[model samples]
Target: MSVTPITTANLLARQLKNLINSGSLKDGDRLIERDLASQFSVSRIPMREAIRQLEQEGLVKVYRNRGAVVKTLDASDIDEIYQLRALLEGEAIFQSMNYMDTETMARAELVHRLLGSASEPTQQGLYNREFHELLYRRCKNHRLLEMINGLREQIERYELFQRRLLSDTLKFQDEHEQILIACQHNNPAAARENTVSHILSAGEILKSYLLSR
Candidate 1:
């Protein structure tokens, strides 16, 4: 299999994406080409390309004369995304549970352990994604998986904010364990319910934070 080449633009895009997801780059922050290029020791061309890539991912918006600014989601956007995620991911996990094996369960448990131990918000986010992806990996519906991933990406910034600003990480991890237990017991219905509950709970916390700000 041929590997995709990583260019300067791709590297820059990944860095910018991480910054955005980690809450270092706040919503509506401008992507100043000159400043970012100097900071990253790159040319303006790649910086422009990087911002364009983030724009494509719905993380950045570009206006005619204003360059790119980080995209901010409103309360409605949060509600819609989380509602869709609850439905789609709930279904995905239910379907995947039908095909779950010992190995997948074991791997998921490992990821969950890692997630609980992860101190940094970014590291916790990564392991959390891995744990959920592992649980859903056995689902045969590739399109469904793609949709779930897309929705998760859209709300990731909010998730990072929730982790950093709220005291709910431990509560969330407890919910994760509950989901894992349901999956391990081969109870698809309970797993689905737990998964949906976990997502909606996180969404509510985020929405409350956003509105209070």
Candidate 2:
């Protein structure tokens, strides 16, 4: 689903995001517009748009005359992203506890089950993305969503990277299920703490991966 055969930038961006998120086009990887366009059977224009989207998300950097390259995030980047997510998404999750309907909650639980049952880490990663997106859908804060989306983008590779390296996704699943249960209880404090702990745990795992790299 992330790898689209189309040439449009939106599709290209989505597919490229998925690649970056899934650890295919890893940190510091150069993304050639021509090669990507050729691979996707599209034109340069859409590929450029796709690059721009990644640029906005802080996943890719563009130079004056050169093409784009995936960012090799350092400690500062992770720190900033985690701090930002703490302020914005922590609130979002707290607000979401009050706003979520039973159907939506059930859907999120379904995502949890799906993530647990996924055959591979890649599928589990995708499920993780969807699960979080669903959790914050009721926040009613467009700017907050945008910010969290970028933060999530910044950490995607680390998530997949750590899981593959450690071969341990069950821990993540356990944490998420706990967070979801907190939401189910309609307890804002519990949801916020659980969410913060979840993000912090991810930061620690990702920190290990970054240090290893």
Candidate 3:
């Protein structure tokens, strides 16, 4: 992959996120200092910052001696995410429809192709985020977008845990298509309803994987 133009911490997050999504950094895998530092070709300082960022995102747990291990998310986190998404995403989409129009719709239509061609899971995941954010930006509500951004980050990272849960992953792709369709049709209610089902389904899927792990 071409080196992305990103901040040191963001670059670290992307690499570690890639590790998790690719199954190299398996769930609950403890981060080894020397190994990761060597692999990333960076100093320990940036590596530590990345770990701290992951911990903030609920992707890693920073223990006393263990350094950092990926968190085994419990049911409560899933529930909260879905609950929050249902509460917020609907309004965000409704507000967005007024701001997003034909040109943005054309661009959104092409984004799916980019996501489909992504070679790796993390790339696909980031594209997935960019896809939704493009639509979300139409809302023109900064605070709402900020809140939803955090929610999306948590949702995406947790969903990454379902690497072998192919069924749910496929379901998400279908849901993404549905979201795009709703946006194209300019139906906010349909878009909102679809998003709620999508997020709630995600919570259920995540719960099964979390419990099994």
Candidate 4:
């Protein structure tokens, strides 16, 4: 078994991604190579490489004079992302219904249970991803799944805020249950509808929250 080594740049990129997703590094915040290198006890080379990685991931934007700034999305961006998510994930779940079996559903149920029990926003978000991925992975459309995951990554920073709200969490859980039930009953239309509705509802809530702030 060959294990890939984790390079310094890769490690720094993952840490920076966590910081951004957790909102520790807010939108529009500048990523200074010298400052970050000193803060992380790394050399400037790896820090620069790390910022480049994030730039490719759409989390950081590089300007000629301003260096790299954390990417910020407006309400319209949020709405558009969720719209795409609904379309892609709805199709994914609809297609995956043909492949969903007892074992997969059982795993999804377990993930849902874990999500309910998760106390921290980050942990809950992870389980939420797990649950959704388990359902969508069986779609057998690799490119479709890739696009869905990419869009999910784009909105994760905003999702951190939504996860922190108990009301929002409760609503999402209920929707998750609806989706799971639809799957178990072999109702693909209902599953897709529930998934679309869930994404749109969450998008609206997040957009409102951001606008109010």
Candidate 5:
């Protein structure tokens, strides 16, 4: 039996990602590499690497001589991110249809069930991503998955806000059900359409809410 080794940078990245997603690292929060290194009890190299990875994911901005700051999304940025999500995720579901087996469908069903029962918006968001990832991951395109996950991460804060501010988590779960059912029935066209609609609808709601803020 072999276990994959977790690199220091990977560990640091995961920790930082959690902080960002949980709103511990608010938008525009400065991230000092030396301070983070000392806080995490790791060397500066891994800390810098983790910050660089987050920057690549659009979660961090590196400023000359000012270290890194958490990235802030404006209305247009949110619109573009969600639009790209709708496009890429719809395509991912379309391409994954042929590769989705009965077992994978079953797994997606289980994730959907869990998502449906999640009580909190934050937890629901986690299960929601899991369910969608299960459906789309079989696209067999690493680059596409990377892009999708990046967009997903970029929307985490807004998702949490939406979930808490609205009573529409159940509505979102219903759409997830529709997508999963389409996948189970081997209807890629329906799944693709539902996936795109689901993303765009959520984006509109979030965009309106954000603009009102």
Candidate 6:
């Protein structure tokens, strides 16, 4: 297997994204460039590039003089993002149905099993992402996949929040199973419907939790 090259900027970006998703970097917290560079042992250049990438992903907002602050999400932000996710992910899964092979289906099943065994919400979330990515990897539209990934990253923090309160990983697993079953049966329309329902249900649950906070 060929190894994918990892860049300094991408590495820094992943670390920063982890901080945000884990809530170590709180919402609206200012990111000091020099401090982060020192912490990560990188120069200002790659740090800035990572910040720019996060900003593009809606995780950070850079100001003229104030520098970068973590973007705070309200209930409305959660609603809008998930709504977009429902639409984009649903369509992507539908398109991928024709292209999905047996190998990908097996991989997805493996990830789903791992998700069931993952005790930590963060680990579960990662496995969940892998499961969906496997299902959607065959999507022919590169741009749509890119957008879906961006949205997924943007909403990961919210997913972490939801997982803290909701212990219904089994329900999510069941939904994932339904989607997989649709794929196994070669039912694209059923797969699309299940995916959209799963996303929208997650959105509603997250929205209610966010509003209650």
Query: What's the lDDT for all of these models?
Result: 0.88, 0.81, 0.75, 0.90, 0.86, 0.89
Mind giving the per-residue lDDT tens digits that candidate 2 earns over 3-73?
75564788899999889876788777899999999999999999999999889878899887766999888
Candidate 4 C-alpha lDDT tens digits along 35-138: 99999998999999999998887789999998999998889988888999999999999999999999999999999988888888778877888899999888
Name the top TM-score candidate. Answer: 4
Candidate 1: Cα lDDT at 42:
88
Top lDDT prediction, candidate number: 4
Q: Kindly give the stretch of ten consecutive residues in candidate 1 with the minimal lDDT sum.
A: 160-169
| Per-candidate TM-score against the hidden true structure | 0.80, 0.76, 0.69, 0.85, 0.84, 0.83
RMSD of 6: 3.1
Q: How many angstroms is residue 32 displaced in model 5 relative to the true structure, after the best TM-score fit?
A: 2.0
lDDT string, candidate 6, 77-192, tens digits:
88898899999999999999999998999999899888877788777767878889999999999999999988888878777765653356467878898999999998999999
Clashes of each: 0, 0, 0, 0, 0, 0
RMSD of model 5 against the true structure: 2.9
Error of 6 at 94 (Å): 0.8
Which 10 successive residues of model 4 have the least lDDT summed?
Answer: 160-169
- Candidate 5 global CA lDDT score: 0.86
Please state the error at residue 155 of candidate 3 in Å.
4.2
Off by over 4 Å in 2: 1-24, 32-50, 64-67, 117-119, 163-170
Model 6, residue 10: what's the lDDT? Answer: 93
**lDDT by residue for model 1 over 56-120, one digit each (tens)?**
87789899998889998889988998999999989999999989999989999998888777788
The full ranking of all candidates by TM-score, starting with the best, is 4, 5, 6, 1, 2, 3
How many pairs in model 6 have backbone atoms within 3 A of each other, for residues 3 or more apart or on separate chains, i.e. clashes? Answer: 0
Error of 1 at 126 (Å): 4.9
